[model samples]
Target: MLTIKEIAERANVSRTTVSRVLNNSGYVSGEARERVMKVIEETGYVPSENAKSLRTKKTRVIGAILPKISTETSSRLVKGMDDILAKEGYQILLANSNLKPEKEIEYVRLLKSRHVDGIILSATNINSGLTGEIKRLNMPFVAVGQHIPELASVIFDDYQAARDMASLFIKKGHKRIAFIGVDEKDRAVGHCRKLGYVDAMEEHQLPIEEGWVQKGEFNMESGYHCMKAILEESKTMPTGLLAVTDRLAIGAMQYLKGQGLSVPKDMAVAGMGASELSRFITPSLTTIDFSVEDAGREAARLLLGYINGESYHEKPQVVHHRLLERESI
Candidate 1:
């Protein structure tokens, strides 16, 4: 119902002065600022964000692209990002990719088109094409969950996390260990974690059976079926199992329950991601706490620094993981 002109007139200040005060750009005397604030408060005036963007060249909004928004991991990360950004007068414009890799790239372009100040991509994987686009966009960007050498990112130590999980079982004297992982397309969660498991197994002189390793999608059903296949095909039963994610681990536990196999006593189990279900499941689960929320907060903080022309170190910021020893192992 009101415009900047009317507010300026009521405050007895030039419209240019009002604009400066509203944008917090040019210097305004304390008296002028107070008068403008009083008039704005009295009139219930709200500045047009579009007009302000045109004047200040800042939308003060960040775009966050995630693969699946409904998951516990994504939800926690978004909350952490929101917590930091909100304090700095910024908000998030979320774009969900529904776990499609191509959609991740598309959302980056779409967010740029919307004139977002920066983008925080919860990257599922990395290739030349995606990296090229990030470079081409030449925008303030940070990748979460996956590490790219060319861009800044906030990532978990997936390899170490997986290795540590395997070591937990090994230290408990598990010789034959089973593994359930997702497609290698997700390099961080699928490939690196598998490599870590393999590394730990080899380090402990444990022989890996051909049928002991199973690959599945990042879901519980996949875990359930994969565990079944392992049970059916493996010549000898595995003493321990390491799944790439908490969902997969939980599914494996369900399968074990159905099969009347006692966890830790019969087959120790562990997973990454530290999902809330890990703590409540029967016998609980040994897992690696990746501190996903911290990753999100750091991603937002780094992206904002880049957008604001501030220096930040640790291009691929590494968030440490903790081993949660539970009844599962």
Candidate 2:
């Protein structure tokens, strides 16, 4: 229950200096800032956010919407965002959609009603309904993991990552390559990644059979089921297989193990995301490192900039990725 007067007294600074340090607005001397921070920490002094919001018209709170919360990709991105926002005295109010597309749009309206300063959306798809709501909200927003036409986004180079994986498979002397991907509604992961894989095959003058391309959900079981379909339906068996996600690739590997096929010998395999389990799995799965955490950090940066009235002419910020070669490929 320490007041600003008591904090200023403890830190040996004027109340104005303490106010500057608390708001992170006017600059105070580095030493004085450190002293004030130390005193606040020691006393466990909590500021009145309600009074601050009434004065400044800023809640200093950001609403973050995620498609799913259980995955490592989501967790890493959240960590990166938290690292940046916490430094600026901002906190996140998370809204998890739990993989339901309808909930994504719903959460946008819900978060907007909460009067948060801004929103960082880990979007799965860019549809008219979602974009329309975002536009109507007229709030600062940054889309992560998916790109919308006019919205600012922080997204990975999904197409290049997928294409690079295909090229690696080709360089390793695997001609008949197969692809397991998600639905086309997801422009980044599903459509762009699949397009890149297809373009790579065509660049190598390798004809792709209809059966070699299988669609699956973003899960291990779907990858297993789609891979099984590829094996059973293809007139000529593929020597290389690339699944869009590590979970899918791992599932495909499981099917191969059940069939008693030797990996990288009888059939080579690779996946996109550098999931934690990818390296530890049998023989280690070759994959691409999309830097999911960096994307989150970038998203937080862009959204905060917008809220602070900084103009970025560029729409979406693109993140880089790397190809990780492992035993599987």
Candidate 3:
């Protein structure tokens, strides 16, 4: 372990000069900085983040709380955030809530306790408990995927994205359309998306059967069951289907295959979230490209703005989405 004093002595510079060069703060002559850098490179000296934080009150670490770490959406978001944060000499500390709302609040306090420079929450649902805790913390924060009131957020146009998909189906002459969604507690995917579908159908004067709508969890198995229920319970069969997630749509397709039905011929299907599986699946899947990575990058930039003393605003930065028309539809 080479101390700053030792490095300064070897470089023929004062310890203060070495400190200034290491911190990239204060002014140091180019010659003196070059000398210090040469000695540090020779000795492989790395500055202590703890010591730097104690002096500057910044850890250079951002805490990211995610709903689920294993999903592709989470990975893409992380990649985007890291792309920006790493360039600015910051690193991410990840906390996975495993889709538990209680864990989200718990991690907020835990991250605050750790004295993170800022927090980025990839929120699934914005509840009062989580929002209240965040407000009390009074730290630099940004929410992604869901908009939080009075806070900076990077959100997707979930409602319009769903509406566009339903319109596409209707344009292709799909009158009897079925919807598979998750719990309405997940307002963005479950509620807004379902509402969009219903509105599009109603606007076109299409009749919706009692069994045309089914609720499921965020998994393929749930989607399979939902599709099965729609088939068994609906008196009039639907010619088109829309699912809130690619996994659910894939599950529904699996059920349709088992029943000896062909896609786009027997039933045209579409899903949200342009996942990799959606591209490779048989006949491919028509889905929404939400550009999740872009959302992550935007969230990081917003948090950094707050951390850097930028003015706070309640307006959310909404990311754009596009529909990928594939063979399924």
Query: What's the lDDT for all of these models?
Result: 0.90, 0.91, 0.94
Q: Give the winner by TM-score.
A: 3
Q: In angstroms, how far off is 68's CA in candidate 1? A: 0.7
Window of ten residues with lowest summed lDDT in model 3 = 311-320
| lDDT score of residue 170 within candidate 3 | 96
The per-candidate count of clashes, in order, stands at 0, 0, 0
Best of the two (1, 2) by lDDT: 2
lDDT by residue for model 3 over 1-329, one digit each (tens)? 89999999999999999999998999999999999999999999999989999998999999999989999999999999998999989999999999899999999999999999999999889899999999999999999999898999899998899999999999999999999998899888988999999899989999989999999988899989999999999999999999999999999999999999999799999999999999999989999999999998998898899999997769889999999999999
Output the number of the lDDT-best candidate: 3
What are the per-residue Cα lDDT tens digits for candidate 1 across 1-329?
Answer: 89888998999999989988887888999999999999989988888888878876999999999989999999999999998999988989999999887898899899999999999999888878888888899899999988888678888889989988898888888899999999898989989999999999999889999899999888998889999999999999999999999899989989998999988788888888889989998888888889888998999889989998975454688998899998888
Give candidate 1's whole-model lDDT.
Answer: 0.90
* C-alpha lDDT of residue 39 in model 1: 95
**Candidate 2, residue 265: how far the Cα is off, in Å:** 1.2
- Stronger candidate by TM-score (2 vs 3): 3
Q: What's the TM-score of each model vs. the native?
A: 0.95, 0.91, 0.98
Q: How far is 312's C-alpha from truth in model 2 (Å)?
A: 3.9
**Model 1 regions lying over 4 Å from their true place:** 25-30, 310-314
Off by over 4 Å in 2: 1-18, 24-44
Candidate 1 backbone overlaps, count: 0
